[model samples]
Each structure stands twice: as structure tokens, then as C-alpha cells.
Target: MYTYIARQAIFDRNKHVHAYELLFRDGESNCYPAHITPDEATSRLLTNSHLSQGLEDITQGKPAFINFFQDTLLHRFPTFLAPEKIVVELLEDLDVNEQLLDACKQIKQNGYRLALDDYDFDLKWQVILPYVDIIKINVSMFSQQEITERTPALKNMPIKLVAEKVETYEQFQFCLELGYDYFQGYFFTYPEVIRNKSLPSSKLNLLELINVSSAKELDFNYLNSIFERDVTLTYRLLRFINDPLLNKSNQITSLKHALTFMGELEIKKFIALLALANLSDNKPGELLKLCLIRAKFCELVSAAKREYNNPPMGFLAGLLSMLDSLLDQPMSVLVNKLPISDELKMALSGEPGNLFNYLQLVRALERAQWQLVTDYAKLLQLDELLVFQLHHQALLWGNHIHLASQSK
Candidate 1:
């Protein structure tokens, strides 16, 4: 059986990733199987994925919030996992009783951090509050008045409050102002488009660099000139190429050599990375990381299938998909300015096609929309396991590139 797992990032107040909530699916249904008990689902997750592959590889060393049914908790399944590596989240549907309370206390005593998932303000749950380190509130489910009235009390306590299912930047700001310690949502993926805003010269320059780099035939002279014009971009590109993790045997010394060495495809990606990093100056780092993951994932999928006549175009499409979010402009406007192929422009502009389906697959995996993932995979004729593996590889590659770009 294939163990399909997707992670949703949990962000701190500053929007830095704090942890990830691991969502598991046994099949294309993208949710728990009807016949499998929650306990069995959790068991299979721990045994097949967490144990076989290890949580560190899955979570990048950050703690994972794994859900536990009352029976799973009572069976001490959490103790088998590393305490430092996971936060045991108790499902809200579980009945609060002596046995549950005792299990909570025991898990707490064993050095496990406990979180209350989808917490509603109920007096019955108060008895177990002492053991809870985090409380997740589905912000979508509560009225503003209800949230204001309920959150203040939780704020006064030692526990951290997490606003779940936040869908827009406005809601994120509201939750931040309301003293939410952590946020869980896809809000960051959206563009906070401000009308009448003009792109500054510096940003326009970056866009030009991206456009030039993305051409069917690379303009080596123009690319080298662009790099030479900005010392920081040149330094970043060189440092990235020379990153010990890249396992380069010889040092890359000059702009010309670097441009020629990386060839057309890699040079385009490097320029895109540098330009996007600069473009995302004030944005969340996770947004940039997501773009990289999408770019690589789309490229890998297209390459594996050998469907797209221009395979590298998938990479370009994925990278530019989030340009709207990074620039705070509509994708339609951005695509108009970019001198890309019609298919790429269409894909980025939300037109449906094979490329669009590739992007949808990445988004579905990110959000743990399993059924949609299956549907997209089928449309693209991709194996579910291959999709999962590609996504994992993309995550690792994206994380590495993001970290490398940040390094001095």
C-alpha cells in the first residue's frame, strides 16, 4: 500500500514556518478511508511513512503535528515517535472523559507537546486545558464577535492560539491583531493586488532580466551585462553555483564563465531565482519557496511524462505562477508584460490546459485536496506514487534553493 502524506505549514506571528501539520491519505480519496478507523489510519501513517522514511526527511527537522484519535492516544502510539519531533494533536470529536484525561496527562508526562485541534470553547474541555500547549481555532467557523469574545480568554492562558483556514491577507492581519500566535492557511499564496500601483524602476529591471533570461535563445551578452550591472545579483548567483551542496568540483570565478557554465536552462532558473528573491523582498519567504517547489515539481512531472514539447516551459510556468503574489499585481497584467510563449502566458493567466493541470496538481497536493490531486494526476496520466515522490523531491529541492539563495 502507498502511504500518501502532505504537509500544511504552520507559521509564527512573523510568518516564518514554525511547524507543519502532516495530512495523511491512504488513497486517491484524499481523506481517511471509510472502512479504516482513525486509529488504523494513524497507525499506517506512523508505520509506513514516518517510520520507514523518517519524520526528519518529511518535516525538514521541524516538528509535525500528528492527529490522534482517543483510542490512538490511549494506546500510547505517540510515545513510539520522538517527543521532540512531533506535537500530538487530539481530534475534536473525541469524547472528554476520565480515560481520555488520563491519557492526555500521561502523554504530557512523557515529554510530548499536546495540541487541541479545532477547539471550540466548551466548559467540558476545560478539565484538560492544563496539558494543552496549542489550541487551533477554525477561524472560518466562528463569527468575528464570537472570536473576539472567546480568544481573549485563551490569550490570557499559557497556550498558543492558531487561526486555521485563513483565506485572505485581510483575515491574516485580523488574526495577527487578535493575538493569534500561529496561522495555518493558504492566504499567503494569494495576491494582495493594489490597483493604481506602479512598478518601480528597480522592480521593472528585475522583470526585464527575467524576461530576457526566459527567452527561447538566451542572450548571453545581455545576461552577462545585467549581472555585471548589479554586484549583489552576480555575487548571489556565483555563491549559489558554488554552494558546497551543489558538489561543484571547481570554483566559478567570473560572470561570463558562470553564464556559459550553467547553460541556457540553469541560467534561466538562476536569473529567475535571483530576480524573484529581489521581487519578494518584503513578502513571506515561504511564498518564494512555494514558487520554487511548484517550478521544480511541474518541470519534473512534464519531464517524466515527456508530454510537453518544451519541457522546461513547465518550470517557467511554475515559477511565474506566483509572480502576481510577489508583485502584488494581477497575473493577467504581469503576463502581458512578460514576453513568454502563448501557452505559458495562458497557463499563468488561469487558462485550462495540460500545464494548468500540472499547476493544479501541485496546489492540490499543497492543500491536501487528495481527490483533486487524483483527478489532476489522472488527467495528466501520472501515477499517484510518482506524484507523491515528485512533490517530496520538489520540497527538498525548493528548500535547498531557498536556503542557498539566502546564504551570504
Candidate 2:
């Protein structure tokens, strides 16, 4: 059996982590006697170090609790905490039985924090209410209309309110304005309107040339003409073509072969991204390192999960996802002119958003952005170490590609 492990950080609508490293299990297996998948181990992921560190960063308080829940078995319970570090989260679908209630009450008496996930107003489940320290509300799950109408009832409870799924900056602002204490989602990365900035003429020309490249029935000479016009682009193009990374696949020689091998449209897109990357020439080495990490991370998760039909697209999604971060442009604006698929475009929008959810999940994992990583990684069927190794490979490939281009 293969499984993926993810660290879940449980939050209230107010965006406080009542529980960090919440484990969840993933991957498929019925083989082993143990019968545990990696995903299952981490499904309610608990890592003492990562959780404590996360708590300290968020609450600036002393560690107060330490315990581990192996499914229903509560083991490794520590004597005491300062009423901060540890928080217990009731999974959204946890059955509300007397036994569970007793467990909740006992944990509360032991001086631990608690939270409820995706909580919608239900007076029946209110039995668990008094025990929970925080409550997470999905902004999308409950309409603005619902909150406006229901706040009066919700205010009667002692639990703190946390808002999840704050997708747009406007939504985030609205939630904050509406008194939501916590925020989660991709709003931080996506701007309301991606500002368009004029590129250097040389850079713009590269983008323009690549955009014009034909995907089918291409003439190598004509395609090469575009690169010849820009010495740097030519250098980078040839470098990527013949680099060790490319060497493992096929030894690319001549402009026509490059065009044919990469496909005209893909070549165009790659060149555009390459030029976008060069926008940060002075800082390429550092950014390249990070971009490679993200790319490789996404590729591994996607590849292992078997989600994408065209595996290379997943790989490219990881690789090119950082174009905006590199160019200081909103990816939407930059990608508008590229020839890549819509799914690849969606990856940049953030994971679980559209067709690129897997790729986006990979991005989240690399940054350790726990908000969407756990759930999505569960879907990807990839483990952390595999993701890490893949990210390392991406860095190596990117470095070779970068070096080869620079040499030109």
C-alpha cells in the first residue's frame, strides 16, 4: 500500500490554528497486515515540532499541551500546557455520539483547545459546542446572506468564529469587515486586477517572437530567425535544448529539430516563460532555486497521483507556474498571451481552484502552505519525501537549463 501524509493545521473562521499538523491518510492499500496507508497516518497529522513552532509563531505563547491521537486511541498525553500550544479539532464528519462527547469533555477538562471544522449552524450538534474553543465556517458553504441572517444566533455561542475560503482580496476584506477573525485561501497570492507592466523592449520582443511561433508545419529557419534577433534568447534557447537535462531525453541540435521536438507552440510558450524568467537576471540563481523546488514538487505529486492525462503538462505546470513570481507580473496577465492550456493557467491561480488543482497542491506543499496542502496532497497520493526528492530534481534540471542559457 502507498499513502501520502500531510500535516493539517486546523483553523477557526478567525484563522487561528487550534490544531496544527492535523494528520490525514491517503493512498491505496489493502495489502499489509498493518493495513495503514501513509495518508491515514498523517490524516490527523501531528508533528510536535512543527505544531509547537507554528503555535509560537502565531500565538507567541508558551507550549501548553502535547498529545497524539492514533485514530481513536489517545496516546502520549502530556500532563499540562499553558492553555495555548495544543488544540483539538473535531473533523467535519466526526459522528456526534455520546462516546465522542465524553471524549471531548474529558479533553476539555484536561485543559486543551478545541475547534470544529466546516461548522454550519445546527442546534442539535450544539452539544459539542461548549467544548470547542473555535469554529471554522466556510465562506462559500454559507452564503453572505446566511451570515447576515445567522450572526445573531451564532453570537450566542462562546466559540470564536473563523472564516475559511477567502478567495479574493475583496472577499477577504469583506470577511474582515464583517467581523470574521480568521482568513484562509489564495487571496494573498492573487491580486484583484493583475497590473500590467511594460517589459523591456528586448524582453517584449522575445515574448512577441515566441507568441508568434507556429506549433504545426513549422519552418526551422523562420523560428530560428526570432531567436537570432535576440542574442540572449538565442543563447538560452540553444542552452536549454542541449543541456544535460535535455541530453537525457534527446540530444537537440539545430533550430528545426528544436522546433519539431518541442512542438512550435510549446517552444513559443517555453521561450516566453524563459524570457519572463530572465527579467530577474540579477536574481536568477535564487529565484531559480525556489522555482525549481516548486516545479519539481508539483511534478512528483501529480506524477505519482496519476491525475493528469498528459504527465508532461503537470511537469510543465510546476515549472512554468512561477513565471509571474519571476516577472513581478500577475500570472493571469502574463499568461493571457501564452499558448499553454487552460489547465496549466489554472495551476497558477492556486490549487483546488480548477483543472490545475494537483499542480496547485504541489505548490502549496513546497511552501508548507498548510491551508490547502493536506487536503490536496491527499488527493495526489504522494508522500512528502517523494515530493521533496522531485523538487530537488527540478532544481537540478532548472540549474542546468539556467547555466546552459547563461553560457550563451
Candidate 3:
């Protein structure tokens, strides 16, 4: 009895992550079970996932857009979740009658944001439109001209428009121009390659630091020199070592002492974090946050198995997974310069292996591809519930790291 859940990020007009739509599945079937009513699916999700482990753990403090059928709304299931933390999404197929309309009014009065999912602008929905806060439109269902014509009416209303199933940069730009308040899709994961864009020397040095730190053996003198040369790196390293979450008994005053305390594993992770924060300066912060989540999630999964020859490589592989998007270079080229192990290189290069399976499992969970998530989890010999729990832990850890980086 594993509780299956996955979230898809929603980005604002500026491409920053705004919220996540939490998708719930009853089983490895990857969708709502045909036998169970939508009402039952929402109930189980609330009881098993939301009630047991607060929503903040899974959503990293972002508001979750969760679907609700007419019955669930009338039953006040939305009341179980925190109003500020969730947006009650009314399914498009819901009957728009007096009872449902009264329920919608009460829900709005209760302080919960309301979203109309897969809205098609029918006159029947107009009766309840005044109570809605957001309207989600499936961009794939309409032509650009149709969208342009249909959207102007929404623009004048207080409601926000969310462009759903947006799959490419061009689509995002068009929607942006059309005044879409938010977007939902995989467009941000694709790299926007700028031809002949050279890596800055400072970033190259950071890459060198990442390469050196990930080595099989620590080069203490070499690492010390690199830290000594860059004051910002030294400051961040010390600050990371002293983060209250790490729980240091005594404050470390020197770089050598900090390295010694962290040993090889923590030092490697720190360097990776430093490089990630520095490299992703110009990109959306969500990319860095995703990398941290993947890194921590992969590390936790491999460490749980206890059968892999080297589990630390799992973290490195996950951390480097987004180098192509961050550096605007192909993964093959980036892996060549990193000096990581062949196994890690193979995994990051999309070749099949234990680490590759781990990366795939994280990705599948991220994209709500439950069958692929089940397949990769089976290949890795991990329990489904454990994977979900580990993903929750990773989200919390990533949120902490993301906040720490921002504060500095």
C-alpha cells in the first residue's frame, strides 16, 4: 500500500516557479484507478499523504493545486487542507448547478484559492466564474488564433490564466505575450543554447574545483590553495560547515579544520553546491533547486540500498545531471571535463547502469510518469513507499539548501 504522489511545477510570467500541481495516483497504473471514483482518489490522498505528512514537506512550502470533484467540494474536503497552502481546483467535468455553486462560494469565503481545471470557456461555466481565482486552459487543444480570441475575455476579469501543457519556449513566449499569469510545462528543463558562448574563467575555476573535489582521493594542498585564492568560496565553505542544520559542536575557524571535519564526502558535496550556485546565477533559481533535490534524493536512494560499490557517486551523478542545461553545452562535453568516474559519466551521459536507473527514477517521479517510476524503482530494488518517503525528505533538504544559498 504505497501512497503515490508527484508534483509538476507551475511558473510565473517571469519563469520563476510559482506553485506545483500535486498529482495523485492510487497505484503504479500511473493514473487514477478506473474503479475508484475521483472522490475516493482525493480522499485517499488527503488521508494518506496530506494528513500523515503535512503538505509543506512535499511542496517545499509552495501552494499545491489539487483536483476536487463536485462531491468532494460539497463535502468540504478542501477544509482539511490549509487554505493558504492549497488551491482547490474544480475539475472541468463538475456539474455547475446551484449546490456546486453554493459550495464554491463557501470555499471562497473559507479563504481557499479556486482554480478551474482544463477550462474551455463554456457559457455554462460562466455562472460560477465569479468565484474562480484561476482558469487553467489546455494550450494543446486550441490554435494560436483561437487562444488569442478566447483569452481577451479572461484578461478583463480578475481571474488569472494558466497556460497548461506548454511544451516549448516559443509557446511560453506566445502565452507570456498573451498575458498568461502562469505557465505549466517542461519548457524550463530544456537548454537554451547560445552558440559560441564561452564559459567565464571564474566558472571554469569553479568547475575545476568541482572536478578536484570529486576525485577518489582528496588533494588537501590543492583544495586549500583553491579556497585560499577565492575569498567568496572560502566564506561560503565555512558558512556551509557552520549551518545550524549541520549541528557542529564546535565552530571551525580555519579552512583546513573545516575540510578535515567534512572529510571527503561532505567536501565533495559542498564543492558541488558551490559550483551549482555559481553556475546557475543567470538561470531560474528553480533549476538549482531541482538539482539539489535530485542530488539529495539520489544519495538517499543509493545509501538505502547499501549494495552499490560506491553510493556517493549517486549524489555527484544527480548534481551533474543538469550541467547541459546550466552550461549550455552537451552533456558529453561537460562529462569529459569533470574527471568523474566512468560509471558516473555513463549515468550522466544517459547510459544504462545503477546510477542511471537512480537518475531515471528521480526524473520519472518529477514528471509524474508513474509507470516509468515503477519500472526504474523495480530495477533499483527499492520499495515504492520508501521511494516516496525519500523524495519527501529530499524536497525538505533541497528547500533548506535553497534557502541557505539565497540568504548568503
Candidate 4:
């Protein structure tokens, strides 16, 4: 469940830090796993860094250079990341096919900066040059003479040259003379390591309870049985149900009556919100608030979509989307433990599915990607004003809940 991310500094010509490329670690080793797709790994890393640990704390307000696979680019996963705060780094191994080219064009049009990572220029790559803002050439991969000869006279192009793996002062000088605009490698320093401290069993159990509550087989009996075992949860449930919104006339005396009156849908939201609040203890409060907003946003969107009748799953999907980051666990591991549907799991895994698209739209709204948000809203046939209002209401609701909790 432990997570870690390292950041290598990217510097401008004046030797000041311009940006950072986030590096993922599989446990103690600071390397991406060979087993999973790079997209999943990067997604998990970004979830942890941006959602769990605030981006400002990690990047110090500098733009982050994040790696993305062709799948991620095609699916527009990077849309969740703020365009002004990220430089999407395209791996060197991706094929220059039509789909990839189209995705590159779309990313550029969306106002995001792009970079070619570990570049060894092939003639086929020329097609991507116009769309990319930066090109990173690995200095160690080639000899000095080869680098000198292969370095393109791209002075006319509106792009910057980055010299990667520059290991010494002499190599830095050589790259600078070769018109490299940015430099990265041990020639500067090693990446700054950030570790996720281990959580106690009590906190993990809270996470487990939250995951268990997200199951599709949720019912009054199942929820009652679970709540009965935990007095604190029972108390919180009764208190939440008796709030003026649910019980405006009479005070609820018993848990069974509370469950009966609140209905399964309302009970599920209560449990998700309470469980999220509990599990997010010691983490940033804004994370829990954001999750709640996303949960409501997805639920509203799903209800708006007449094609799908299931809104509870949509709610759970949004609530649990950032659970991995909140708990510092891989989403695959966490979602597998939940008794949720395969469709929900697929959505959580960043697979392209119904709930996945909903989650993506919710993410776009979260980052205030207005054009993308408007496009999705139109596609879903949702009123743009309503979408904005729902988002605003969700934010206010989150704030109200937080304030109420603070008062208590």
C-alpha cells in the first residue's frame, strides 16, 4: 500500500529550475513496474501526487513533466491534470500512427505543453514536431560527434531543445553550445524522493469499511448489520438521518426506522460521505471535500443520463475514484478488495467504459477545463448551466458539511 514519487529537476538555460518530471517507484526501487501499463502507473502516481499530496506541496508551484502512453493520450486522461501545470511527456517508443498523431494535435489544441521524451530523432517523428513544445535528447545514448551531427537545426521551429542525461560540466557545456534550452540529469543532482509513511491498522480498517460499503449488493439489512457492530458509525448514521434535510418534522428514535425512511440511496450517500471523512483523517481535508463533490457530480450526471438507470454505482465510482490516493494504495489492489461490480472496477482502473467516461467528465469539471467540460455536457445532453450549478452546489454542500463537522 506504500507509495513513492521522485522528481528530477528540469532547468532552463540560466540553470534555474524550470520544471520537474515525476518519476514513479515500485516499492524501494525508483523504477516503473514492467508488469503494468505505463499509463496505469502514471495514473496512480498522479492520483497520489496531485490528489492525495497537493501538487503545490510537491512541485512548489512549478509545472510538472508527466509521462504518458499513447493509450492515456488517446483517452484524454491528461485532461484531468491542469494544462498550465503539466508538460505532457510523450515516450519515445510510441508509434507515429494516425491515432497517436490525432491525439497529439488534440492535446496541443487543448492548451497543454508537450514534450518528446528520450528522443532519438527518426524521420517519422518529424510529423509530431509541430505539435510538441519541447524535445528531449538523451546525451548518454549517443556519442558527442553523433549528437553534434544529429542535432537538428530546428531554429525556425517554435520548440525548445532539452538535453537529458547530461552527467558532467563538460557535457552540460557541450549541450548548451548545441542549442539545448533545458538540461536534466546527474550533472545537476538526483531526483528528490518523497515517501508515503505507513498507516496503522486502525486507519486501514476504516478504508476497508469504506470499500465494503461501496458494494452493489448494498441493502438495508446489510447496512444495518454493519452499522450495529460499530457504535460510532451507528451514532453518526442516526445523527445524519435526523438532520433537518431528512427529518424536518419528527426526530428519528431507532436505527431501523432511520434506514427505512432514509431509503437505500440516501443511506449509501451518508455512509460514503461519513466513511470518506473517517478514512481521510490526517490527510488534507480538501481531498475528502473534493471526493464528496465528485460523488454528487457523478450521481447527478448519471441521473441526468436517461440511458443509464443506475445512479448509486455512479456515486460510488466518484467517491472511490480518489480513495487509492487517500489511502496511498494502488487502486487495483483496493478495488479488488471491494465487493463491487466489474464495471466499477474497470472504471476505477482507467478502462474506457460507461462509468469511466462519467468519471472522466467529472474530472474535467473538477479541473475547470471549461471547453472539455462544455463538450462533455453537450454530449451527455446535460444543460451546461445545470452542470455548473450542480458543481457549485456540490462545493457548497461539501463546505457546509465541513463547517457542521467543525462546529460539532
Q: Model 3: which ten-residue window has the lowest total lDDT?
A: 306-315
Candidate 2 all-Cα RMSD:
11.1
Q: lDDT: which is higher, 1 or 4?
A: 1
Q: How high is the CA lDDT of each candidate model? A: 0.86, 0.55, 0.85, 0.71
> What TM-score fits each model?
0.96, 0.48, 0.93, 0.49
Best by lDDT: 1
Candidate with best TM-score: 1
Clashes of 4: 0
lDDT (tens digit, per residue) of candidate 1 on 197-316 = 799988988998889867888787777677676788888888888887773686889757766666667777788888888898888888998999999999999899885543288898
Off by over 4 Å in 3: 27-35, 51-53, 307-311
Give residue 190's error in model 3 in angstroms.
Answer: 1.2
Off by over 4 Å in 4: 1-199, 217-225, 307-311, 404-408
Q: Is candidate 1 or candidate 2 better by lDDT?
A: 1
| Model 2 lDDT per residue over 1-408, tens place | 243333333333443334333232332321112455332344333332334234454222422222233344233232233444655656666667776777778878887777777787776678888888777778888777887777656667676776667666677767777666555454544434456666667766656553454132344566566677867666677676676655567777666777777765556545544664565463424345445545555555655767554325555565566666555577767777666566666666554543377566655654455546556655556564465446445545554554555554
**Global CA lDDT of candidate 1, please?**
0.86
- TM-score of candidate 4 versus the correct structure, residues matched by position: 0.49
Compute the lDDT for candidate 4: 0.71
Better of 2 and 4 by TM-score: 4
C-alpha lDDT of candidate 2 relative to the true structure: 0.55
Winner of 1 and 4 under TM-score: 1
Give one digit per residue, the lDDT tens place, for model 4 in 1-408. 223444566878776668877655443223466778877776666666433346655555789898888788888878887898889999988978999999999988999999999887688899898899999989899999998887757645788989998866578889889888999875532111123546676665565556556655456565566666678766775676666755688787786676567665566677777777777665545556567767777877777775453337888888888877676667777777677788889999999877887887777655434556667766777776677656655655655564344322
